[model samples]
Target: MKDQIRSLQRLLAALSSRERAALLAARPAVLQQPRPRTLHQLAARLLGTASLSRSALNLGEQQFLEAAVAAADHARGPGLPFVCGRRDLEQLLGVGRGVTADRFAEVLRSLTALTLAWPDGDRVWLHPDATVLFPTALGRSAHGRPPLPAAAPLVVAAPTPEFRPATGDGHGSGAAALHFLDKVLGAFTEPWPALKQGGLSVRDVRRLARILHCPEQESRLWLHLAVTLDLVTERHGRWICTERVPGWLRTPPADRLAYLAVALADVQILPGLPTQDPKLLNQSFATTGPSTHYNAATLRLSANYSAATLRRTVLDVLAELPAGQAADDGPALAAAVHYRAPHLFGPYDPTKPPVPPRPDPYGHWPKPNVAEVTAAVLRETELLALTDRGTLTDLGRAFRRDPGDHAALRAAAEAALPLQEKATILADHTVLVPGTPSPALAELLRDACDLEFRDVRTETHRITPGSVRAYFDQRPGTDPQQLLDALSTRSTTPLPQTVTYLVRDTAARHGHITVAKAGTVLDVRDPVLATELVHHRDLAHLMLRQAGPTVLLSPLQQGPVLEALRAAGYAPNSELKPSAARAADRSEAMYELPQLLLPPPRRRRGPGVAAPGEWLADLSVDEHEPVGELARFIYNRAPSLGANDCNVLATALGAGTTVHVEYRTPARTHASVTVRGPRLDHADRLTSAAGRTPLPLSLSGLQLVLAVPDGRGRPVRGK
Candidate 1:
């Protein structure tokens, strides 16, 4: 009894109120069968007791019996209704009593916290006895549906939990940690406060741990690694990632080569920005400014070689010289350096000192052969200099300044009578071999000679052969017979000729085209014809007629026809084509021979009359029209005919009467026939091959000659 009550009290204290009620409701068969025959019996059976009591069982003993009864009752119906609950529940089961609601509530709260649920509402109902136990408010309502049995609370089967090996903090084995850090650093491009935070909080650590599936401590270690690598900087309580880390990590090797090429070319590297040039750290190398030479070399290497080869070339070039020597090498070394580190050489300042010279691994240094190249450079430089220098010498400078003739010989040649005419005039003057003057002295001799005879005005020259002869006769100590000999000596034709020397030197100044105008008439200096025109009356008359009354004869020979015209007495003023004579005695006279000699009056067509087909007929005496009119006139005069149809035949002859035709046979050979037609109707059928369908024919398509027949029966193809 007291023992039972004490046991129940302990059980109630252990369990939640809801759990207790659930246990009491599931009455076992032992509780229901029969109270043991005596107190000793009940005690022994229920509590394994050896003594009996009259008072109620202790709380412990009471709970033991209640649990036993509930188990038995559950056997009759089902097991416990809830897995966990309170003490008063046993009182309602008839096994024990005197439990409080607060205590019961505490039990139920524990059961609920453990996530147990009630099966039924408010009370626990027994199966066979139909006994019901009302629960305290904490155990009254169902919390949720009862959980499945397989998902019921598990007992700790093994004494000790299974051993899990400790993961070492990320000091030595931190590949995953390092990778995580890399990712974190990779995300940031600029300095940010989060990264610089001193240590991770629970949330931060848990987040990193969840991502990595590792311990929080390990995540903290990875972050520390990032700070050490200089990938990120710690400031205040956050991490600030440096910009260079991402650049170094993300840029690929191939992109580096492309960057180098652009840098060498002095072109922009990044979008919308120029590359920066850094001064070389070394001073041993000879420094030359940006050399187009190096730039070109870099371009060629980049284009022709693979990236690896180019990289090797660059490294090799860098290796060949002393550490401080690259500064002196200038753009050459900078170009090589550019191949390896493009981002480092943004603006490519040529004035900067060069990078240290790295030694060549292969011991083979490349030196450009520059002698010929330098020569080419020098040549271009000189040409540019000369262009800037302008022309040399006074005459050349004058030509450069004003660009007129600056050479004595050229000026002399231009001043002379044109060389061709000069030679002719010189020959006529008997100053040189008649036609064999030398080209070298020809111009000079022409300039030396001047016309000796002038008429009263002293402006016009007679230029007669007699005047020339007279001038020669008057020469001091020279006979007329010897004049020719002296003239030959002066001309270029005679070697070592004294007179020739004087002529060559002096004529250069005076040779010019001779112009003579007399009484509204102009004449050219003609040494050949001057004497003939002046001395012969017949020749003068011929000249007037042939050259018109405004005669200007070149003093050269006139052809024989002029002489004949002079003999006929046709003077310069005679009318060439005469007009008709006036009527005699005020009456028209028609004489056939006289009329034949006179031009007929022009005739025009009256209204409605056909226009003249002949162009010559339409002409006003000598006027001309298009040549087509002649062709039309010729086609009108001849008529010939043959056709399968009379309609076509009639069409071939217009009222005026002539037609010409050209036809092609079935064999494709051409043939001609003349046709007379009045209109063009049905001509297509006439021209069609003997058995073929008719095709339209145009007169324009034929090649034909037509003419009217003359009285002699000859084809009058033309008048």
Candidate 2:
């Protein structure tokens, strides 16, 4: 006892405090009492010792116990073993089977200390004495018989262990036994039977062995054990698991087995194991060295993923994405996987896994299997169900909607296509320009093509041949055919000669015109012809301001000439025809100058005509009379006007003579003027000096009034 306590203490010391407490608390219930007797033995002893009256003997308790013992004994030999009978026990206990059935549980408890063996769902014998009980009613019954009253009948309990399976072989055992169990149990738990129902092939045992890092022999042995136990049974030539095992195991071992199975089911094997292989499976296990146990024959499984080259791949697939989409899971996964392992291929989202990575020599990160990663990411993030056929969840769809990721997906799709197809697809679907393609676009195209292409063309034609022809006329000496050929060769197609001529004719009219004070250039070459069209009217107006107006010729006729001059609002002696008209009408019949250069108009006289002096006299008496008053007023009020030119004095005094005057100038303050001319001529002299002189000194500057003519003294004009 002392040694036992010491051993327990050592065990306790090795365990964590929590584990120790659990073990200690469970010990009383788990450990059997010394010399424990079976329920039958106890019943027999009690029956002998108890002095029961005839009435008591007939009470049903003894009958119940007897019936229970019989049933238990019968089970011990049996086709189908069970601890108690439903009908027999009920009659003995004088109650329904439901009530008395629980009472028979004592029999099973009694057998616990005796190492009794029975088959689980699988036919493998599970020893009760070696098994641990889970905290459950049945588990309790298996641990000990139910306590009963003196008159109550004794019953047996069912013998079955209830416990969870461990993740690994922590309990020390030999490699041989483990290998045997692995094969037997692994085979029974294979998904082949279930998969076969779905029309999928069951992965081979050797393939599973490779995944589980075990030998082919061991794997086969495990399958045989499974068959013996009935966990797996052969149907035809194919091996399959019994449906019962799945229900028996609380959590299926097949889950782990399936994981391993899938991992190895598709792996590709080389002719010989190489020193350096890119595949993770090619590497040997830490504990198990490389061996022939997994040779070419056994290891010849298809790989789920293909080998890919790694390179510097950008991880931020979502950088430019706008939110929401159904297919965005792939991009979302890529973004997440890339973010987590920028150097690796990540930013992989479990909701949406990226497409499988491709091989690239210049790539910065290792390429991964896009499809596999995408599926894994979706599963990891719970955005998709394992049983679901790669459908994205609502959240996954939303994530896929992001624009940046969408673009990346498009790029990835293009990359997946054949080179020629990819190029065509990019050309049709992308916004990339010929010379200014985005780096991403350029790189993707290059990868798709599998060759280098210039990003931008340097020695390429910019202007189309049509555009050139549209601006220049095809002159007689020019090689129109050669020009057309050059343009056709430079551009995608040649400009039609007819179209070229139209454009050239139109362009020649206004080609010289550019941006001006008016507005943008519309057309230019034939200012007159173009101006006639309203489309170029505004431009024409501007051109006219620069080049003057065009004119047409007419025959020499007084009436027509007069009509033309009058319609133009021209003054007498100021009819200037256009040069064209002037050339046609020689003999000095007409001459033309710009309207800006036209001479001033001549003043009118009486009925027929008037002399200059006579007109001057009339103006002096009527309007010039005020000039004298104004000059007198100026000399009296302000002498500034009289300081220089005396022409004003002559005009004011009604004298038709010239005058010499002198005054102080502003700079030298000394001013002088020699006799110039009459102050008033048929045409006002002031007209020639418009804007040049300080003030007008002629009748043109005055307001004239008519006065009664006096019979004497030069015939006074009316005021």
Give the clash total for candidate 2: 70
The lDDT values for all models are 0.30, 0.31
The alpha-carbon deviation from the true structure for residue 582 of candidate 1, after best TM-score superposition, in angstroms, is 42
Give the range of the ten consecutive residues with the poorest summed lDDT in model 1.
Answer: 267-276
Per-residue CA lDDT of model 2 for 1-719, tens digit only, reads 11111222233234443542343242232211111012221111111122222122211223333344444334344222234444444454444433444443333322221212211222212121111211121212333544322232432322111222222211111122323343445544544532223211224544656654555534443443344345566565345667756443332222222222222212222211121223543433211111212321222212222211111111123222223212234444444334323322323344653443333486232334333444333332221111112223222232244413433333322221112111122211221223322234333333222222322121111233343443243232344444444333323333445534543454455335543243222233455643353333322222223323332222333333433444545332323466544553454344366577668888644333333223212221112122444454433332222211122443523533333233222332222333233243344332111222333333312211111122331323211
What is the Cα-based TM-score of model 2?
A: 0.14
lDDT of predicted model 1? 0.30
Clashes of each: 95, 70
lDDT of 1 by residue, 526-554 (tens): 53443444445654533332143334443
Off by over 4 Å in 2: 1-333, 346-371, 376-719
**Each prediction's RMSD to truth:** 52.5, 50.3
